[model samples]
Target chain A: MKYHILIAFFLLLTNLNKGFAGGGEGHGQAFDPAGTAIHHISDGNVYTILDGIGVTLPLPVIVYVPEKGWDMFSSGHFHPGHHEDGHHAYNGFVLHHGSIYRVTDPTFPAEGSVEVQGFEHELENNGGKDKDVYYVNFNGTKYRLDARSTLDGGVLGGGITSFYDFSITKNVVSMILVSLFLLWLFISAANAYKKNPNKAPKGIQNVIEPMVLFIRDEVAVPFIGKKYPIFLPFLLSVFFFILGLNLWGQIPFLGSVNVTGSLSVTMVLAVLVFIIVNVNGNKHYWGHIFWMPGVPGPIKILLAFVEVMGLFIKPLTLMLRLAGNISAGHIAILSFIGLIFIFGKSGESLGGSVVGSVVSVPLTMFMMAIEVIVAFVQAFVFTILTASFIGAATEEHHHDHEHEHGHGHA
Target chain B: MTGTLAALGAGLAVIGAGLGIGMVGGKAMEAIARQPEASGDIRSGMIIMAAFIEGAALIAILLSILMA
Candidate 1:
C-alpha cells in the first residue's frame, strides 16, 4: 500500500511538471528542430547529455602537424558554448567541426586566450555592423570563427584547416566502449565454458551459447559449408558489434553516438568484408569472373566487365544501406520530437505545443520500438549477406557426370 | 521547395519498397505453410530478399537527401 501511494504521488508530480511546461506562453524563439536533429546524429567532439541544460562532456583532441610535430589537448579548449569556460586556442591549434586547425595570423588569439564571441566586423565584406571574429590560418589561407563555428569571411573565402586530426570524438569514444564490453562478455563466456567443459551452460554462457550456435547452424553451415569454421568468427563479431552499437544508440541519457550511421564507419566495415571475401575466393570464383568457359568471346567480355564491377558495387551498397537505415531512424524520431516546438511557433500559444507533444510523444515511442527491431534485423542481414558472399567465393564446382562420360566412351 | 521535392522522392521510394517487401513476406508465408519443417530456411531467404529491396529504397532516399 505504501509503495502504491509513492508511485501514484510520483506520477502526479510528473503530470504537474508537464502541465507547467506547457502552460508557458509565446516568449522565446522556436527551437530549430533540423539543427538539433543534425547535431544529435552527426559526429561531434563533445557528447551532449542534455541540450537544454547545456551539459556536455568534451573529448580529447589529438592532431599532428608536419611542422609542429604533435599537439594533444582536451576538446574543452574549443569552448562548447558561451556559458562554458575554456580557452579557444591551444598550442596555436583550434577545434572546428570536430577537427583541429592551426592559426597563423599574428593578430589572432594566442594559446590560452579568451574566446571572442561573434563574427569580426573588419573582415565582414557586406555593408553592416562588424561582427566579432577570430582568425585562424590553415596552410596559406585565412579563416574566421564566430560563436558557433568557423565562418567563411577570410582571405581564402571559406573555413580551412591544415592539421591532421586524430581526435577521439564522441563516436570514437562510444566505439571503444562497445568494443571493451564485447571483449568482456565473450571472454567471460569462454572462461565459463572452459571451467565446465562437459556440463550444460549457465548464466551468460547459456545466453550467448545459443546465439553462437544460431550463427553457426543457420548462417555458417548452410552458407559456407565445409569452410564454415574459417568465417564463423568474423560473422559472429560483425553481427554482435552492429547489434551492440545499435542498441547502445537507443539509450536516452548516454547521448548515444550513432556509430553505424556514420558513413566512414560503415565504409570501413564493408571494406573489411570485401577484403575477406576476395582473399578467401577459390579458383572457380576467379574463373567465373574473368573468363567464362562455355560462353562466346563477345558475351564473355561483357560478363567479365559486369563481374568486376559487381565487386566494388557490393561493398559500396553495404556501406550505404547500413548508414542510411540507421540515420533515417534517428531523423524520424527527432523530427517527431521537433513537432511540438513547430506547433508552438504556428499557433503562437502554449496550447498548440501541448497538443503537438501529446500527439507526437506516443508516435515517437512507437518509432523507437520499431528501431529496436530494425537494429536486430540489420545486424542479421549484414551477417547473412557476408556469409553468402563467402560461400559463393569458395564453392567448388563438381563434374561427376564427366567421369561417367569417360566410362561410356570406353 | 527543394526539400519538399526531396521528401516526395523519399515517399515514393518507401512505397516501392513496401510493395516489394510485402510480396517477399507473402511468398515466404506461403512456402512455410506448404512445408512447415523448412520454415527456418524459407524465413532466412525471405529476409535476404527483403533486405535487398530495402537497400534499393534506402539508396534512393539517400540520393534525394544529398541532392537537396
Candidate 2:
C-alpha cells in the first residue's frame, strides 16, 4: 500500500510539472523527450510535403494521410494542423496566401525527362529566391517539384515529393550500404568456418573460433549439459543476429531504428527466447515451477503462483530493457542537437548552441563507444539467460547427490 | 518532463545493470584464468545471473521507451 501511494504521488508530481514540455514530447528525439522550445515542427529536422516540382509555392498547410505505406518503426512526416474530427486531413497541399492545391493522378517520372525552369527557389532548396517552376524525372514522366513566391514576397512550400515513392532516402541509401557490409562480413565468417573444419584455424577462423568455443562451452555446455552441442548453433545465432542489428543501428545514416529501442521489436525477440527456453526445457523444470521438489504441500501451492508469474516477468523485462536503452540513447542525442534551435530564438541562443553542441560532442561519442559494447553485451546476456532458463527446467529439481547423502551424513 | 524523466531513469537503470554484469564478467574471466577447465561451469552461471540483472535494466528501458 505504501509503495502504491508513493508511485501515485510520483505520478501526480510528474503530471503537474509537465507544463514546460513541447507537444512532441517523448517522440524519441533523444536529448529532450519533450518537444524542444527552439525547434518547432516548421524546422527542417523533419521533411515536409511538396505540392509540385520545386520546393516553392508555399503550402502553409499540407495534410498527411497515414497512408497504407506508413512505417511505424520510423520517425515519419506529418503536417502541423488538425481538423475538428481529429484527422490530419489536408487537401493534397494547400498553398500559402489562401490558395489550396490538389494532388494529381499517379505518375512516376523517369530519368532526365522533366525540364528544369531556370533559377527559382524551392522551399527545400535554400538555393536562391527566384520564381521558377522546375521539372524532374524519376522513371520516365516529367514531374514538377518547386516552390513559388506568393504575391506578398513570402516563400511557399519547399518540398519535392513523388507520387509513387517508397525506397528512397539519404539515410536509407547508407543503410543499404551498411547492410551489404554486414552481409559480406557474415558470409566471410561462414566461408571461413566451412573451409577450415580441421587443421589449425587460419586468420578469421582464429578470431571467430574462440568466441564460438566460448559460447559453446560457457553458455551451452553447463546449462544444457550433455546435449549442449545441439543448442550451440542457436546460442551463437542469437548473439550474432542481435549484435548485427545493434551494430547496424550505429551506422552513420543507415544505422537507424533503435531496434534495441523499439519495445514491440524487443518484446517479440524476448517472447521468442521465452518460447525457445520453455519448449526445450526438461520435465523437471516445469515440475519445479509448478509442483516443487521438497516443499510442504501447502507452501508448494503458494510457490506455484509465484513461479508461473516469474516466467512472464523475466522475458517481459528482457524485451523492455534492450528496446528502452537503445531508443533512449537516440532520443537523447537528437534532443541535445535540438536545444540549439530552441535556444536559437532567444538572446541566450548563442550560449545555448555552443554549450549544447560542445557538451554533446564528447558525451555522445563516449556513449557511442559504450553503445557498441552494450550491443554485444546485451546479446550475450540474453542468450545466456535463455540457456540458463532452459537448463534449469531440464536439470533435476533436486540434487541427486543430496538425496543419496541424506541429511549431511557423508 | 515525464518523457525526460523516463529517459533519465532508464539510463540510470541500465548503468546499474551494466555495473553488475561487468563485475560478474570480470570475476568469471578471473576465475577462468586460475582454473581453465572450470571456466565452462563458471561462465554459464555468471551469464544467467548477468542476464537477470540485465532484465531489470531492460524493463526500465522498455517502459521509458513506451512512455516516450
Candidate 3:
C-alpha cells in the first residue's frame, strides 16, 4: 500500500510538471496564475486531459449566425495547436483559448478551412468601459472576432455578438456523462430491489438506500410534511445530481470540468427552483407575501414589499452560494498547484521547483479532501434549502391562534 | 488601484463569513454537547444557517471579482 501510494504521488508530480510546461510554452509570457486558474475553471470547446502529453478529446462545434445560418462540424477540424488555439479557421470560425470566435471582417473567407496566423488580445474602449477585444490574424490581415453571444446583457461583460455557440462544450459533456452514470446506477439499484423483493439489500442497492432514506427522513419529512412524497423525487434528483457533478469535478485528470462552478449552470438550477416554488405556493403563501393578516394597512404594504424582495433574493442567493463555493475550491486548489511554477520562476530554478513541490503536494492533497466534504455539504445545502422553500410555500397556516395565545402569554 | 481595492473587498467579505460560520459552528458544538442525542438535527440546522451566511458573503465576493 505504501509503495503504491508513493508511486501514485510520483506520477502525479511528473504529470503536474508537464502540465505546467505545456501551459507556459507557447505564450512566451510570464506565468499568470489568475489567468491560468480562470482558464482551467471556465468551460472549453475541447477537452484537454494533459496538455503537455498532447492528449485532447475533441467536442462538436455548433454555431449559428444571422447571415450564415447554422454550421455544425467537429472541433478537430481546427487542428487545435498550443493552448487549444486553432491552427486553421473552419468556415470563418476560429477556436482560440478553447472557445469559438467568428471572424467579422468581410474579406475573411466564409467557407472552407484556411490557415490562420494566430489570435491577439487588445483592450478596446466601447462607450465608457474598456473591453478585452480579440482579433484573429489571417493572411497577414487582422480581422476582429466576435465572441459567442451570452444572455447576460453585458452585465458580465458578455452581450449579443455576431453568432451563438450551441456547442457540446466540456461542461455539457460532463453533465451528460454524469447524468448517464446516475441513470445507470439508480436503474440497476431499482432492478436489484425488484428482483430481491423483500430480501436483504445488497450490492448497489445498499449503497443508494441509505442516502435516499436520509433525505426522505431528515429533509423531506421534517420540512415538507405530509406532502413529502410529492416532492421527494424532485428533492432526491436535485441532491444526487449536484452530488454527482461535484464528485465528478473533483476527479483529477478528467479535464477538471467545473459544471456547478459555472454561474450559468447554477443560474439555470436556481431559476428552476424559483419557478417550482412559486408555482406550488398555496393561498397562504401568497397571502403572507402580498398582505400579512392582522397587520396595520401601511405596515402590511411595507412588509409586502420586503417579502417580494425576499422571494427573488432567496433563489439569487442559492445560485451564488453553490457556484461561489465550488469555484473558490477549484481556484484554491489551482493556486496551490501554481505555487510550483511561481516559486520555480517558471522552471528557471530546479531547486525552487523541488521546494515548491514539497510544500504544494500536501496542501493540494488537503484541499482535495476538504473539497470532497464541500461537495457533500453544498449538495445537501441546496437540497435542504429547496425543501425548506417548498415547505414554506405549501405549509398550511395555523399561526393565527398561536399568535394570539403567544400574545396573551406575553 | 482598483484591483487592490477589489482584493481588499473580497478579504473583508471572507472575514465576515469566517466570523459568522465560526459562531455557528461553536454554538452548534455547544448545543450538541449539551444534548448529544440531538446532534443530527442540530448539525443539519447549523449547516443550513451557515449556508445562508455564506450566501451573503459569496455575493459580496462575486461583486468584488466583477469589479476587478
Strongest candidate by lDDT: 3
A113-187, model 1: which lDDT tens digit per residue? Answer: 445332211335333323334554434345564332223333212333444567788889889999999999999
lDDT of 3 by residue, A1-410 (tens): 99788656644574455455434324656777877788789999999886556577889998989997998999998998777788999998999888889888879998999999878878887775678888888878889989889998788989998999999999999999999999999999999988889899988988899999999999999988999999999999999999999999999877778999999899999999999899999888888888877779999998888889889889999999999889989999989988877877777767777677778889999999999999998999999999988888888767655443111000
The fraction of reference interface contacts (C-alpha pairs within 8 A across chains A and B) present in each candidate is: 0.65, 0.80, 0.85
**Residue ranges of candidate 3 with Cα displaced over 4 Å:** A1-25, A125-128, A404-410
Error of 2 at A14 (Å): 32
Rank list by DockQ: 3, 1, 2
Measured against the native two-chain assembly using Cα atoms, what DockQ does each of the candidate structures obtain, in the order listed? 0.51, 0.37, 0.61
Higher-scoring candidate on TM-score, 1 or 2? 1
Cα-based TM-score, every candidate: 0.80, 0.56, 0.94
lDDT of candidate 2 over A361-400, digit per residue (tens): 5666677777787777777777777676666655644556
Which DockQ-derived CAPRI band holds candidate 1?
medium
Of the two candidates 1 and 2, the one with more favorable DockQ, higher being better, is 1
The TM-score obtained by model 1 is: 0.80
Minimal lDDT window, size 10, model 1 chain B:
B59-68
Best by TM-score: 3
CA lDDT of every candidate: 0.71, 0.51, 0.86
